[model samples]
Target chain A: MEKKIAHFTIDNKECTATTGVSIINAARENGIFIPTLCHYEGVKPAGSCRVCTVKVNKRHLTACTTPVAEGMEIEVDTAELNDLRSSVIELLFTEGNHYCPACEKSGNCELQALAYRFGIMAPRFPYQFNERDVDASHPKIYHDHNRCILCKRCIRIIKDEKDLPAGSQGRSIFAFNQRAKKVKIKLDDRLGKELSDELAQKAMDICPVGSILVKETGFKTPIGQRKFDKEAISLDNSINLKAMKEAHHE
Target chain B: MSKPVIATTSLAGCFGCHMSFLDIDERILDLIELVEFNKSPIDDIKSFTKDCDIGLIEGGCCNTENIHILKEFRKKCKILVSFGECAIMGGLPAMRNDIPVKECLAEAYLSGPSTVNEEGILPNDEELPIILDKVYPCHEIVKMDYHLPGCPPRADLIWEVLHALILDVDIDLPYELIKYD
Candidate 1:
């Protein structure tokens, strides 16, 4: 007898599949769309920005983080769902200093495209304007506190993929003061210091908003030419897994 | 069997709600058949009886006019639903309560950007009602039968609730839709 599988809906289209598959991946496979913010396939689902909120049965859920169940009815479009998503996107604009006029990642930015797509005419809510200060720590990485949505994509890339101390120093998980306790102690031995500028750049590339920008890449790629960046960013799934394993072993 | 008589009104709101209701698209006919919307401004119905099955009061009661209208609905409707987040949680209008009433008045009248309140604009004299310290939900002012929580309650959810009400079935929240952890 065959094992029973779960059913997940993608943009109102339904499909039956096995477990251990994310809705984002399943939807893509079935030619359905579930737009994501902090999720890159084969990398990790950060569930930040809350953009891909699809209705499961009667709920507005983040399609990336939410696991597929045996039977789920989903609705991906409607005024209410759009309203909630649009409001979330609007909140992202209002929460920080996302001034696209001066942004480094302006054209290559997902936030701007989504805003255009959603017809965000103006900022409805008065800007909270958190007045966040910059973090000038890394030699190459310039932390513009203003653009940081605090999505922690850099943190994930740093910790999981690159295995670096700077990535492990997230405020929510580990505060600024506690940086030296775990990963920071290895700093003295230069052997574990494999955090390359390219790795950092990839993390920056994965960032949906202009929160993370490669200091050099800005204005080089141009706007419309950098289309592939917006094209479904799934990290490890389509990459050379063998090379990744060999790199880890050495 | 008489259909549900629904009366809808807006107070201190942008009326984006009524606009959103029209956005339901093709469902408006179904909604109309489900409920007898006799007093909606959209219908241009000037007069309606208080003996309504469902009374959906949008916006929050700030002035005497709102209070009077709320009381009238309470006197008339059987089920009073605090429609939008303003009616439910006092919304952005309610958020103004965070400031001192004196400061709010000062900003509106003198220090504000527009800052000019003509005779009709300014509520002058002792007769002018004092601002409440904080915005209270409709539940605080009057008994609410059911609440549909949203900035503006989703048209689909509203439709579902109305359908359930008409069928005498319960409007239950599905667990899959909420954030537990």
Candidate 2:
């Protein structure tokens, strides 16, 4: 069956997308970058973080979860939206003990990148200074609750594929056991011991912040050489978009 | 008109922010031309001799002395800037906020690995400033007009803010200039 395509307008630009596609992915397909923290490629959108909140027909809705509809009008880059997004970033900073200077993910952290994009000099809200624990029980990955934005990327991305047939078909074999109000990314003890280095790296990469880190190796990249040091995150994306536009022109 | 008077001080911090300010290097000559130092370690000035236009404060208030100096800065300076992570959000010193004051004292003086006092002596000199229960960001103690967040705020950031303030121009802080580390 042919998928029904929906026509929409985002930030006054006309956008056409499949009916079931989330607004964020649709915007991305059209080269319109909507800043997000929790939303990851290929993972189910949780809409836990409101960083990607946008006005849909004059009402606030998370772009990551909201499906693109026919003739839907969306506002992404309004001043009010930017201010609201900045406030969310600030609240996340204060709520967690984010000592960026000492953190392993100082340069590459998405949270810090968002702060830089928003020009957040300081959080308007008072710092909570909540004491959180670090879990280094796993041999490969260490989880620092202090830096976790509760994005649930780890919880959602890593999954069990034990029931599937062996070989190329049985790649995914991890599970997360978390409860409401108290969410934690858990790995089975036996599976954790036998977890491949690739999977461990995947977990670290999936995390937007510096919450999950690989043990035995850190600070490998120097200060100036690190990601988001020479250029901002969005700058790279915009550059790519520009290059693509130029290619199309040619 | 006279050059803008700038005052600076380190409170409960390690003076790393001051060091980063010094990282401005040759820009100091330009800064000198733009603004005059007052009651700053740059000139070894002991106290505020006159009303200042700008005050760059490092670190948070962890002791009575910090509170006193911060209050004085609020009174003397027209604009107070929290100059680093310590001043903006309590920084490394804020780690003790989780622990009780008594435990912190015990860890530092009596039961610490570095402690050599057999008498379990905790410094209680009358001349010494009393320690606050917990370290506090400068904004909590006094109204802060601006904040430059970093362990030691980036040198370019300090220079840019100073330059903007002195020239009476709007500051357009670039992404590279506004790092937390």
Residue-wise lDDT of candidate 2 within A1-250, one digit each (tens)? 8999999999999989899889987898887878888877565688999999999999999998999999999999999999999999999998888988889989888888889888898898988877777889888888888888888777676655565666533433344456654555556676677777887887787678898899988998998787788677673443224434655686
TM-score of candidate 1 against the unseen true structure? 0.46
The window of 10 residues in a row where model 2 chain A has the poorest summed lDDT is: A235-244
Candidate 1: docking tier: incorrect
Cα lDDT computed for each candidate against the true fold: 0.60, 0.85
Off by over 4 Å in 1: A1-4, A8-12, A160-194, A228-250, B1-181
Question: Which segments of candidate 2 are over 4 A away from where they belong?
Answer: A162-184, A235-250
On TM-score, the leading prediction is 2
Count of clashes in candidate 2: 1
- CA displacement after TM-score superposition, residue B111 of candidate 2 (Å): 1.4
What interface RMSD does each of the candidate structures achieve?
A: 14.0, 1.1
Expressed as tens digits, the lDDT of each residue in A1-250 for candidate 1 is: 5656787665556787666566655555565655556665545677877888888889877877877776777677678877787788778876665655456676556665555455454444555544554554545455566666655555554442334566464222111223321211111123123446765576566666665555655677664355333332223322223224545786
| C-alpha lDDT of residue A244 in model 2 | 45
- Which candidate achieves the best DockQ against the true structure? 2
